[model samples]
Target chain A: MEISELKITIVGLGLIGGSFSMALRELKPKKLWAVDINQDVLKMAETQGIIDRGFLKPNIPLKNSDVVIISLYPEQTVNFIKNNLNNFKRGAVITDTTGIKDKILTEINNFIRDDLEFIGGHPMAGKEAMGFEFASAEIFKGANYILTPTDKNKEENIKLIEKIVMGIGCKNLIKISPKKHDEIIAYTSQMPHILALALVNSNHIDGLGLFVGDSFRAITRVANINARLWAELLIKNKDNILGQIKSFEDSLINIKKSVMEMDSDGLRRIFEKGSDMRDILWRL
Target chain B: MEISELKITIVGLGLIGGSFSMALRELKPKKLWAVDINQDVLKMAETQGIIDRGFLKPNIPLKNSDVVIISLYPEQTVNFIKNNLNNFKRGAVITDTTGIKDKILTEINNFIRDDLEFIGGHPMAGKEAMGFEFASAEIFKGANYILTPTDKNKEENIKLIEKIVMGIGCKNLIKISPKKHDEIIAYTSQMPHILALALVNSNHIDGLGLFVGDSFRAITRVANINARLWAELLIKNKDNILGQIKSFEDSLINIKKSVMEMDSDGLRRIFEKGSDMRDILWRL
Candidate 1:
């Protein structure tokens, strides 16, 4: 499918959705549509030229589309897919930019009409800032683009969606088992937010944190209240994120045990292990 | 005092020393002497042109000079200061570019000669690569240059050292007690490396990481290890680093508890507290 000929519907005109729309526009999709719960945001998205059209709700006419891209939070993504499945054109490929995927995959498998297949996507990109104003097309450049397709997705559907991501300037094409994808992301993506949340709150004694230095500023850069979004998602993907958090917690406890006993050798091992790992990551 | 009139001696001639020398040269210091135990590294430093003159071994004439700087690992920093103390000229201002200071400060306070005090210098600048070849005067530009001067340092001595850091490109001059500096850095600087280390190692499991995607790479980039150097310091400051590790551990356990019980309210409270702290940090 040629970039200019493809029609795109971006559900949820928040940061990810708005930004994805901007990236899609660069590929010059035929018609860019925006959907959001907030009518004011949809209007703003249209005025800002983020999309060619805006919808206050998803159930409105969306038939003029080749692909339906869902960018809602983890908890809302599946239900949003269900609500709008009837509106999509026949054989249209549905995908999402949601952080958690296993749950969403299961929902699509169980709830969506058999005719409409939902391929999963998570362009591993974002920034500290939130909302539509901070959205930009270049955010996807040099970033990983994932395509998760179930048994139901036609081979053509997966390739068409993959072309969209490639045309939008992503660096690599990654196709992984849906379960495997969610497990790794839970560790790298969801858990960091959880840990950042923990780091900020742990030191927040009596609200005297105003004097925090650049260290705290750098570490907890993402801890700000996207509370409704992050909180709901954390609950939805609790098992995997909790496991990642536990592994990190165990590492911390081990280091603490070594330090308290003044066991230099033991502590050194941990640092060595940590450093070796960091070094490997740089190469990758 | 103008930079052209100042005499400077930089010991160890590695990344920190070489970079300091290069930057100070631009500020027009009168004469610079570089010393290192490694003859090859000393030759490399001279060829890199970070110093005007160089030494492979310690010499009395250099020790008797008015100013001496030691830029070595934390373990070697105190010994270097103590070794040069008796042979130095009277009233010579000594300083070091060691990462940690509390223990070094206490050791110097009790052991060093009264008239010649060692003021600590910690320029918060770094890179993944090491050695004089990787050193650039530009690294220190705009970084926070901390001067930890104990009561042992005379007012005149403190002013002179501060002038040198300011002469180089450091923009922020922060004065902090050695204990506080150690405690804060334990959390900010030291702990981040540890976290990066653990994160990288955890991701390296099963060689299955071959398919590891972008978010994993982004989060674990800092894990790359300089094992010999980092292990040495992590051991020396085990107690403080442990305290920080424990605090983070407690946070993870608490979040895990909230998740296990499916307590949405508990999760929100935790997320909100972290968000508030993170938001404020981002503002700055």
Candidate 2:
């Protein structure tokens, strides 16, 4: 289907929503309706033309939009979907940018109206900086956009969503199961953030600011984390996240063992592994 | 006190040493001497014409040089001083480019000839790369240049070395005790590498390649650590590094606690602080 035929409504016009709207507009969506609880943010977004038609709040029923994308927190996403299910078009494809999948999948499966199809998507790109001020239409360019669907998801809806994501400049879209998606993210995204956050929190950065090298700051830079949202997401996917955290802890222990024994070789192997792994990952 | 009057000898022709030579040449130093174990690397340096004279493993005594800068690993630094301390001209200011200093300060303090002043320098910059292939003359521009001197250091020599460091592109020179420097670096450089190594090692990217985002890889890019050198450095500064590791653990625990409690507010505070810290630090 063409963009002009798709009436896209994006809830939560924050960083991701605003950027998505800007990027998707390249396809020339006829009406890019945005629903944000904050009228001020949405008004500024309107001024910037991030969205053509916008709603200040969820007070009014959503129009029969072709697609409804929730860019809210994982838990908040479910509640929004529940409240809006009745108002959306009968065959509209629903999707969200929430980081986790298990809780969202279960919630959507439980409360989603039979008439609507929800195919979960995750665009794998972001910056150290957030918000629309730094948001760009190019963030998703050449990045992986995962299309997660279960047996309940219709193939037509999945393929349509995939095509729409591609319109935003994401070059790769891979199909995956929701459970595996959560687990993989637990290892890659969640665990790394946990380690970065822990490293920053534990280090004496506040008092000994001047001594920090660019490398140290660069490495632990992610430590100043978004705690509230992260906490909810981490516990929400506790099994996967906790498992990944344990793997990280185990890795640290191995390093500690080598250090304790004065085993420079062991330590070198670990560093070599990390270096090699990083190189290989980048090879793709 | 112009560069034209100064005679300098750099023992390593890698990134740091090469940058030093290039910077000093701009000063038109009277004589610029270099020694590298790799003669091919020496030939590469000669092409740059920064050196007035070059040696592959200089048999000529480094003692005759007015300023001797040792750019090597922490352990090899002591070895370099050991093999050549007797050959040094009286009152020569000996410096090095080792990241950790506590061990270096203690290891060589008693044995150094009273005539030679060990004024250590640590420039906080490097790529994920190594050696002369990726070396740039301008890497130290606008970067932190640290001067670590003990009380035993002569006042005049300190000024002389400071003048030389500034003569290079390193404008932000900070003076601190070697112990304090090491302790701070424990949190900053040493610990970050260890965390990176652990993260890279744990993820086993070789086996599980496709699930990575640029953010995950970006944060752990440092994990492609120089293991041999890093292991030695970590053990050499074990006491301080271990302390840093502990602090990092403590920080992670707080985040873990926050996550366990599903505390989004706490998570955002960390992100806010991280974001604020990065903004301010990057400007510096």
Model 1, B1-284: lDDT tens per residue? 56577677888867888788888878777778788878887676668666777887667546646788889888688887777666777778888888788887888777888777789888888777788878888988888888888877889888988888877888778888787777777766676566656665555234334345543454455566466677666666767776777787787778888888878888888887777766665554
- How good is model 1 by TM-score? 0.88
Error of 1 at A227 (Å): 2.5
Error at B203, model 2, angstroms: 1.2
| Candidate number of the best DockQ | 2
Poorest lDDT segment (10 consecutive residues) of candidate 2 chain A: A200-209
The alpha-carbon RMSD values of the candidates against the true structure, listed in the order shown, are: 3.4, 2.8
Which lDDT tens digits does candidate 2 get at residues B1-284?
Answer: 56678788998877778777777778787788998888888787778787877886554737568888888888888888887877778888889998888788888886998878898888886677778777776887777788898898988888988888777777688998888887877777777778777776676323245677655765776777667778888888888876777777776767666666767677677656655655565444
Residue B50 lDDT in model 2? 73
Task: Supply DockQ values for each candidate.
Answer: 0.41, 0.54
